[model samples]
Target chain A: MAVLPNAGADALLMTPTPLADWLVVAPAVLPLLVGAFLIIVRKRLHWQAPVAITTLALVSLASIALLARVWSEGTLVMTMGRWLPPFGISFTVDLLGALFAVANSLIALGCAISASRRVIRSSRRYGYFAFLVLTAAGVNGTFTTGDIFNMYVWFEVFLISSFGLLVVGSTRAQLDGTMKYGVLNLIGTTLFLIATGLLYGIVGTLNMADIMRKLPLIEAAPLMTLATLYLLAFGMKAAAFPVHAWLPASYHTPENATSAYFGGVLTKVGVYALFRVLVMMFPVQLLELQTVVAWVAGSTMMLGALGALAQNDLRRMVGFQVILGVGVMMAGLAIGSAPGLAGGIFYALHSMVAISAAYLLVGVIERRSGSASLNALGGLWKDVPLLGAIAFVLVLSLGGLPPGSGLWPKVMLVQAALEAGRGWLTAAVLVSSLLSVIALGRFFLLTFWRPSSTESRSKHDGTPRVLGVLTVVAIVMGLYPEPFVAAAVRASDGLLDPAAYINAVFGEQG
Target chain B: MKTLIFRTVAPYLTALMLLFSVFILLRGHNEPGGGFIGGLIAASAFAIYGIAFGVPATRRAMWFHPIAIAGTGLLIAALSGLTGLFSGTPLLTGVWTKSPIIGFDISNVIIFDIGVYLVVAGAVSSIALALESTEDNH
Candidate 1:
C-alpha cells in the first residue's frame, strides 16, 4: 500500500521507526497468525484444542505485557509500513485500550478452556478454533488501532469471524440467529463506513487523533450529523436501547462458549468504539449529543433490566444483563465528567469479566441439569455447591450488589451524576440496580434455592475450574478495586484531554 | 445426465481458466487484477467443472479440500506480512528483493496477493461444494 503524505510538514518529516514498537502490534498479530495456523491444521481434530488453547495463552501473555508497557510508559504508537502519522495505519495503545485488550485475551483464554470441554466434536473439526482465535485478533485490533478506517476494518474482521462462530453447526435455530445477527451488524457496519467516509470528507484524514485536533475548525452542523450517525451505528453494535433487539434475539441461540465469548468481548468492542469516537475524538464539540446519549443510556438500562426480569431462560436473562451493562457504560459517557468516564471504564472492565463468567456458569448449570430453564433447575445448592457458590457471586456482581466489582462502578457513576445535578440519571442508575437485583434474586431463588424435582447427576468437567478462576478474579477486582479504578482514572484523563494523545502520535511539533 | 458437448469442452475450459487466474494473480500488484478476482475466476472454473461432470469429480480434481486450501492461503498471506519483522520494518511492509538468477525484481506483495487469491477461491469453492452436495442428500 502506498502511504499518502500527511497534511502537515511535521508529519511528513518524521520517518518510520524500527521494529521495537512490536509491543503495540504483537497482541493483535500473534492471534491472527495463530488463527491462520489453526485453520490449516483444522483436520487434525485431536490437536486443534490443545494448539488453540496454547496460542490463546500466549496471546494473553502478550496482551498483559502490552498493558504493562503502556501503563508504565504512557501511550504506545506504531505506524505500519514505515509510514508517518495520518498516512500509514497506526496502532495506539493507551491505558484503556491496553486494559481492554488484556481483558479480551483473558476472556478468550477462559472460553477456549471451557470450549475444549463444552463444544461438540463436529464443531471443533469444522474450524471453530480458527474462528475463535480470529475473533480475539479482531477484538485486540479494534482496541489498539488509532485510525477510524482501520477500526472499521477490525470490526469487519471481528464480525465475520463471530458470524462464522455463531453458525458453525448450521442448525435451524443457529441459522435464524445468524441471519438476524448478520443483517443487523451489516447495517451497523455500513453506517459506520458512511460515517468514516463523511469524516474523511470533512477532515481529509481518518486518523482519530488528527480528527480530534482538527475538530474545532469544522462546522458544528456537519459534526453533529456525523456524531448522530456514529451514535446510531455504534449504538446498534453496543446493543443500546432501540437498536439492541438483535443481541437478545441471537446471543442465546449459540453454544454457551460462543455466547460467553460474545458476552465478554464483542458488544464491548462496539461500546469501546463509541467511547473512542464520541467521547475521546469529539469530547467538547458534542456536548448536546452527549446529553442525548445520556437519555438513551437511561432508557437502555431500564428496558434491559425489565427484559431480564421477564426472562425465564438463563442465557436470555444473562443476555439482557449484557445490554444493561452497555447502558451503564453509556451513562458514564453521558455524564461527560472525569469521574463519570472513569466509572464507565471501570464498569466496562468489571462487567466483561463478570457477565462472561455468569454465562459460563449458566453453561455449567445447563450441562448439569440438561436444561437452561429456571423452572427446570433446582436445588443446585445441595447438589453442586461449588456451582451454586460461583453462580451466587456472579449474579451478585451482575446485580451491582455491595462487595462486588459491579457496585464500585455504579457508586462512582451515581456519585458523578449526583454531583453533576443529573438527579434523573442517578435515579436511573439506582433503579436499574434494583431491577437487576430483583431479576437476579428471582433467578437465584428458582434455580439454586428451591427443592430439586429430578435425580439427574452431572459429570465432572474442567469447565467450572475456568469459571472459578474468573469468579475469583471478579471478587478480587471488587474487594481491591484501587488499581482498576486508578487505571480508569488515568484512561479518563486521556479521554478528556486528547492533547497528550495527539502529541504522542505527532511528536512535539503537534 | 451430463451433456456430451459440456463434458468434452469442460477440461480445456478449466485449463484455460486456471491459466487466466494465474495471469491475473501475477499482474495484480501494479494493475487491476488481484487475488480476490483471480480466486473468483478459479472457483468459477471448478464450478463449471462440477456442473458438467459432478461435485465428486471437482473435489478430486482439486485434490486438497477447499477449506484446507483456504487455510493454506491464509497462512501464506500472514507469513508474507510477518516477513517485515525480520527486515527490521513494521508488519505487512512490502519488501522487494532482486531475483539473482532471473535478474528481475520480486515483491512480497505478489505473494500476499496469491495468498488472498487462494483463500477466496478455496472459501468460495468450499461453500459451493457443500451446497451442491447437500442438494443430492435432499
Candidate 2:
C-alpha cells in the first residue's frame, strides 16, 4: 500500500490490510477480462457493436479511476497472495504506467469507437476486435509487469498481436508491411531474449526488483553488455533512427482505424518499456552511459524529421515524424537528471495524445477525401472548417508551439539539457523543433492551406463523435498539464528510488 | 493406397492431436509440457492434416485464419494475466488454493492454463494453415 509505507514491508505486512494499492491494480486489469468476455459473448448477441463499445467505455472509466488514484497517491504496489517481497510476484503502479494506461486506453477507446461501425464490415472483424484487445492487454502487461522476463514476454505478446493486425486483410501490401514489421521486431525480440537470459544468469533472478537490488553488488561488465543489447532492442522498437526501418515499412499498411490504434498505443509500449527497464533497473549505467544515449536520441530525432519531409503520403509522413518524437522523448531519459526524466515522461504523454489526434484527423481526412496522398490531395480548408480546426490544433501541438502541451515538454527538456551542461542539446531541441515545424507545416499548408484542385476527392467531415473525442483530449491536456506533470514527477520519484522496488522483491533493501 | 489411408485419417488425427495438446497444457505447470509446446504439437497435427486434406479444408475446419487464431490466443493469455490486476492482486500473479477432496483435484488456475492452451494451440495451427494456404496458391 503506497509503496509499502517506505519502511520495512514487514511492518506493513503484519496488517495485510487493503489500501489504495489494491485500487490501482483493479484498473490495470479488470476491464480486460470483462472486455474479453463481452467481446466473445457479444459474438452471440444481436447488438455486438454496442456491447463491445460499452465494454471498452467501461475500461476507459476504469483507467481514469486508476489515474486519479495514482495521481493522489504516489505509487501503488500489491504483493500476490499475502506473500512478502522476494517471495511473490509483485504488481506495481507508478506514474508512467498510470499515465500511459489512462491516456492510451482512452485514446484506444476513441479509436475503437471511431471504427467500430465500419470494422464489422470486414468478415474478419471479430479477429480485429480480438487483436485490438490483445494489443491493449499486451501493452497493459508491458507497462505494469515488474519482472524483466515478463516484460520481454509482454513485448512479444504486443508485437505478435500487432503483426496479426498489420496483416489482418492479407493483401500484398499488408504482407510487405507485416514482413517488415515482423522480421525487424523479431530481431529485437531475439536480442531481448538473449539479453534477458544473460541478465538472469548474472543476477540469478528475473524479477526486476531482485535485479535492481542486486545490481549494486554485481560486476558491471555483464550488466552494461546486456544493457547495450536491451537499448538496441528497445531503441529499434521505439523506431529510433537507423533501426527504425520496420516502422515506416508498415505504419501505413493497415486501414486508417488500425493505424490509429497503432499510432496511439504500439510504439509507446517501446517507450514505456525503455523507461521502465533503463530507468528503474539500471540507474548506475543510465548516468554513466548518458552520452551514447543522448547522441543516439539527437540523431534519431533529426533523421526522423528529415524522413518525414521526404514523404508525400500523409500517413507515411506522420509515421516518420512520430519516430522523431521518440528520439526527443528518449533524450529526456538520456539526460537521467530529474527534470530531464520528467520532461521525457511529460513529452511521451503529450506526444501520444498529439499523434493520435493527428492520425485520427488524417484518417477522417482520407475517409472524406478518398485519398491520403499529399500529391493527389488538395485543400479542404475552404469546404470543411471542422477538419481544418482539428488540423490546426494537432499540427500546432505536434510542432511544439506555445500554449500547447507539446511546448511545456519541450521547454522542460531544454531546461534539463541546459542543466546537464549539454548546452548543445538546447540548440538541438531548437533546431529539431524548427525542423519539425517545417516538416509538419509543409504538409498541412499543402493539404489544407491551398485550394482543392479539379480532380480532388471530395472532403468528408469526421463524425461529430470522432472529432469530439480527440478534440476534448487535445484541449483538456493542453489547457491543464498539471495533472500529467504531477504524475510524471511521482513516476520519476518512484523510478529513481530502487529501494521500494528492491525491497518488495527481495524482502530487504540489502 | 497408403497415402489415401493417411489422407482419410488425417482430419480425425487432427482432432486427436488437439485433444492431446489440451492434455499437455493441463499437465504443464506440474510437468515438462505446457502451452507453447502443446500448441506447437497441435499445430503440427494441423499441418499434417493440411497436407492430407489441403489448406482450404484445414482452415475451413479450424474456422478462422492462422493469424487470427494467434491474435485471439494472445488476447486470451493476456486477459488471464489481467484477471489478477482486476482482482486486486499483482499483475500476472498466479492465485490458487489447493484443496484435497478425497479423489478430486481442481484449482481454477487450471482455467488460466486453459487460456494459455488455447493461445498456443491457436497460434501454431493457424501459422501452419496460413503457410499451407500460401504454398497452395503458388
Candidate 3:
C-alpha cells in the first residue's frame, strides 16, 4: 500500500505546501479511509448509509472545488512522498480529469442516496456501503492519477469491489452474471496491463505527461501497436462493439441502485482513459487508426440501439443504451477533431447524469409496479403522473430530443462529422439517434401510456424525490448549456494540447 | 487430521510459527522478510491450528472476525500515510526517526508494513477457515 519513494528530511523543507494540494488528493483518499471505516462499522446498519452519504457529499464538494481550481489554474499536481514528478506517483488533475471527477462524485452521491432503499439489511451486512465507497475511491483515483500503471491499479480496486457488490445476495443469476463479468473484465485488464508494460518498456516511464513528451521521439511502428492494444482494452471496458456483451449481461443482475452506479460511472472511466491516452499520448497513432475506429463506432451505435429495441426488460434496455452511449463517445474520439472530442465529453457528462437517473427511475417503477418487464407493466402515466413526467424528461435527455442535455452534444457530433466530410459517420449518428428514440419511446409509451396490464400497488417512496432532482438538473443543463459547452470545449482543448498538463507536473515545484 | 498425536504437536508447531512470523514482520524494514511473506507464514500457522482443531475453536481463539481485522488493518494503513502531514510533507512520505529507538528503527514505514501484515493474515485466514468449514459440512 505504501508506494512511497525514498526520501530524507531535507526534501520536505524545500517546497511550501498549500491547501489546494490537499484538495487534489481528497477525492481519492477520503473515500478509501471512509470505506475502511465503513467495513469496521458494517454491523451498525443505521450508521452505514449516513456515513456513506456524508462522505460522498464531501467528495462532491472537494471535486467541485478542485474542478474550479483546475479550470482557472490549468492542472493541479500533488506528488506523493514530496518527490518530484517523473519519480513520485503524481496525482494530476487536468481540466478533463477535474470535470469528470466533479461529475463522478455527484453521480456517486446520487447513487448512495438511492442505495438507502435498494440495499437491504442482509446486503448491508455483506458490506455494501464499504464496497460502494471504495468503488468511488477507485474511480476518483483513476481520474486523478497521472501514472498509467496507477490507473490499472484503480481499475482492479473498483473491479474487485464491483465483484463483491455483484454477488452481495449470492443469487444464482448474480453469480452467473459475475462469472461472465469477471472473466471478460479480467481479460480486458490483462490486456491493459500488457499494454502498460509495453508502453513503459518503450518509453521508460509510466507518467502520462512524461510519456507524452517522450513518445514523439520513439519509432512510430511500436507506438501504433500500443495504440491498437489500448483501443481494444479500453473499448472492452467502455462496452463498445464486439466486446460489450458483459455489460448488458451482468448489469441488470445487480441491485437497482448498484446498477445505477455502474451505469453512471464505470464505462465513462474507460472513455476518460481513452481520451487521456489516445488523444493526449498517442494522437498521431489515433489518427492513423481513425477509419477503423469510425467503423467500430458506427457499428456499436447501431447494434446497441437495435439491441435496446429488442429488449422487454426495462433495465436491460437501458443496459443496451449504455453501450449506445459509449459508441456515441467513440464517434467523437474517432472524429479526432476539436468539436468531435468536445461533443463526446459533453455527451459523456450528460449521459452520466441522465442514465443514472433513468436506472433509478426504473428501480422506482419496479418497486411500485412489482415488475421490470415492459410487457407486464402499463398505465403509469395515469397512475403516477409525477413519475411519468420524470420518465419523459429522462427519455428526452437519453433519446437526444429537444430541450434536454443529450441533444446539444448529438448536434455537435453530427455537425463535426459533416464538417470533417465524414458523411457516413454523420448518417450513423442520425440513424442511431432515431433508433434510440424509437426504442426508448416505445418503452415510455408502453410502460406509461398503455392501459394497465395488472393491478398496481403504490407505496410511499423516496426515489421520486431523488429522480426529480436529477431530471431537473438534466433539464437545467439543457436549458442553460453555455457553461457546460464552454467547459467541454476547454477540456477538449486541454486534451488536444498537453503543454499545460506537462508544465503543471514538471514546472509547479520549488 | 485431528488425531491425538497430530493435535498434540500442532499447538507447539503453531506457536513457533506464529513467533517466527512476528520475527519476520518485525525485521522487514531493512531485511529480506516483510509483511506479505510474514503474514503468509502466520496464516499458515492458523490454518494448521484450524485443521487440527475445528473451525469453531479457531474462531474462538482469534476472537474477532477476520474481515474486521482486515478492515482495521486497512484503516491503520490509510491512517499511517497521514504521518507525513504533521511534518509538512505530502502523503505516504516515509517519516523516519533521527536515530534508532532502543537499537531499532521505528517509523511510520514499519507501521504501514505491519498494517499490510494484518490485512494479508486476516484475509487469508478468513478464506482458509471458510473453505475448511465448508469441507466439514460436506
Candidate 4:
C-alpha cells in the first residue's frame, strides 16, 4: 500500500489491500451495478424479477457483513479518490449507520419480493426494478457517506429515482401523487442544499468529521441559524410537524410494493440525517435548540397519532404512523442523553421492520379484497387466518404494546426522559402510545374482527411469505432484545462522543 | 405537421451538435464543459428533430431506447470505479496509464466522464420523448 505523504496531495494513496474495505463500498455499488444491468436487459421481462431478487439478496448480505465489521472495528472510514479527509469525499460507518443500512437493505429486499410478480405482469413498460434498485443505492449512499455535500448528492439520487418510481405506471392517481411528492421533496432538497451552502460558508469544509472539529471554534449565533435551517429541511424530509402534509396525501396512492418501500425506508433516511447532523455534530452547540426540538417532538407524536385515529383508509393510517415513528425517534434525540440516543436508535430499527411489514400485510389484504378502506374491509380473519395473525402482531408492535418490538424502545425512551428530568416528554410518549393503541386497535377490529358482507376466499400472493419472515424477525427481537439493546447503547456512545469518529477520519491530527 | 425550415436544417444541425457533444465530453476532465452540459446539448438537437419530423421519425432515428442508453451509461460509470479497486486504491481513484507510442495520457476519469455524458443524454431524451409521444396520443 502506497501512503501519500502530503495531506492534500493529488497522488493516489493506496490502502494495504482493497478487499479489506470492500464491504464499505459494496452495499452501495452492487445495487447500482445491478440496476444498470437490469436497465440494459429491460425488454427481457422474464429476467427482471430473478435478477432483482438476486441483486438485493447480495446487497443485504453485504450490508450485514458491513454491520458486523463495524461492530467489531468501531467506525470504519474510506476516502474516495485516495485524497485526504477534508479534501476528498469519505464514507464512515458507525454502529448506528451500519444498523440502519442493514435494516434498509432488508426492507428493500422485502419490497423486491413483494413486487416481483406485480412488476413483471403490470409494470413491464415502466422499468420498475431498475428504479427500485436505484432507490436502494441512494438510501445506502445516504446512510454510509461521511461528507455533508455527498449526503446532499445521495438525497438527490434518492429523490430522482423515487420520482421515477412514484409515477412509473402513469395512472391519473399516481401522476397526481407524484406531482405533490415531487414538488414538496424538491423544495425540501433545495432547502437542504441551501443549508449545505451556509454550512460550507461558515466552516469552509463539508466533510462531516472535519466540520465537527471546526464547528466549536466558530461563533454560536450563526451555528444556531444553521441548526434551524437543518431542522426545517430535514423536518420536511422526515415529514415532521407543520410540513407533513405531503406524506399521507401521496404515500397511499402508489402501488402497494412501492408504498411499502417508501413507508419503511424513505423518511427514515431523513430522520437518520437529522440524528447524524444535529445530535452527533452539534450536541453541545445546540443546547438551546434542544428544548424547542422537544416540543416539536411531542407535537409531532401527538399530531401524527391523532391523524392516524381519523383515517379510515389503511395505508393512510399507516402513513401517519410513519410520522409517529419519526416523532418517537425525535423524542430520543431531544432528551439528548446517552440513554435517549440509544432509545432512538433502537426505535428506528424496530419501526423500520414493523412499519414496512404492516404496510405489506395491508397490501396483501388490499390485493384480495380490492380495497384498503377499513369501512369496506371485514372478516379477513376468517378468510386468511395466517395473514390476520401476522397483522395482529405487526399492529401490536406498531402501537407499542407489551411483548412487542415497539414497547421496548418506548420503555427505554420513557426511562431516559425520567432520568433526564424531562417529565413532559415522558408524558408525551405515554399519551402518544395510548392514542396509537386506540388508532391501531380500531383498525384491528374493523379489518379483522367484524363479520363481512361476503365470505369468499381472497387471492393468495407472495407478500405473506416475505412479510411473515419480517414478522418473525420482529417477534424474535422483542423476545430477546439483549443484542439489539447492546448495539443501540454502543451506537449511542458513538453519537455522544464524536472523538472516535473524528480521529478515524482525520487520523492523529484530529 | 412538418415545419419546412426545421426539416430542411435538422439533419445537419443534429450531426454538428452530436460532434460538439463528444468534444465537450472529452474536454470535461480538465474543462468546464462536461457530460451534463454535453448530454443536454445533444438532447436539444434531438428535440429539434422530434418537433420538425414528429415522434415516429425521431424514434426511428434513435434506433434504441434512450432509457437503455442511460442504464448502459450508469453501468460504465460504476465499472470505471472498479479500476481503482483492481489497482489496490480506494473506490473511484483515478488510475492513469500513459501510452508510450501515442505520448498520450489515459485515465479512468475520462471513462467516467463519458458515462456521465451518456446518462444525462439518455435521461433527458427519454423524458422529452415520453412527453412528446403522450401529447401525440392526445
Using TM-score as the measure, the top candidate is 3
DockQ of each: 0.49, 0.23, 0.51, 0.57
What tens-digit string does per-residue lDDT give for candidate 1 at A1-510?
A: 333334464443345546667878987888888888888888788888898899889988888988888988889988776567778787888888999999999999989988987688899888898999999999999999999999999999889999989998889989999999999999999999999999898899988888889888777448888889999999999999999999998999888999999998899998899889988877665588867988999999998899999999999999999999999999998998999999999999998899899899888888888899987889889888878888888888899986777989998999999988899989999999999999999999988889988886766665478898999989998899999999999999998888878877887757
Top DockQ model: 4
Please provide, for model 3 over A1-510, each residue's C-alpha lDDT reduced to its tens digit, 9 standing for 90 to 100: 223335564443347566557888899999999998998888999899999999999999999999988888788888886766687888899988998999989988988888886688999999998999999999999999999999999999899898988889889999999999999999999999999999988989888889888899887448899999999999999999999989988999998889988998899999999999999999999989999999999999999899999999999999988999999999999998999999999999999999999999999999889898988999899888989988998999999998888999999999999999999999999999999999999999999999997777776676467778889999988989999999999999999999988888888441
lDDT string, candidate 2, B44-79, tens digits = 887888899887777788786555455456456656
Which candidate model has the greater DockQ, 2 or 3?
Answer: 3
lDDT of 2 by residue, A136-163 (tens): 7677767766777767877886787688
Each prediction's total of clashing residue pairs, residues at least 3 apart in sequence or on different chains, is 0, 3, 0, 0
The predicted structure with the larger TM-score, 2 or 3, is 3
Off by over 4 Å in 2: A1-28, A31-48, A80-84, A123-126, A455-464, A503-510, B1-31, B34-102, B130-138
* Model 3, C-alpha of A439: deviation from truth (Å): 0.7
lDDT of each: 0.88, 0.73, 0.90, 0.87
RMSD of 3: 2.4
The TM-score between candidate 1 and the true structure equals: 0.95
lDDT of 4 by residue, A47-163 (tens): 887888899999999999999999888899888888877877989888888998899998999898888867645575567888888899999999999999999998998898899
Ranking by lDDT: 3, 1, 4, 2
Candidate 1 local lDDT, residue A38: 87
Clashing pairs in model 4, backbone N/Cα/C closer than 3 A: none
User: Once model 1 is optimally superposed onto the true structure by TM-score, how far is the C-alpha of residue A72 displaced, in angstroms?
Assistant: 1.2
User: Ignoring the other chain, what TM-score does chain B have in each prediction?
Assistant: 0.93, 0.78, 0.94, 0.93
- Per-candidate TM vs. native? 0.95, 0.87, 0.97, 0.96
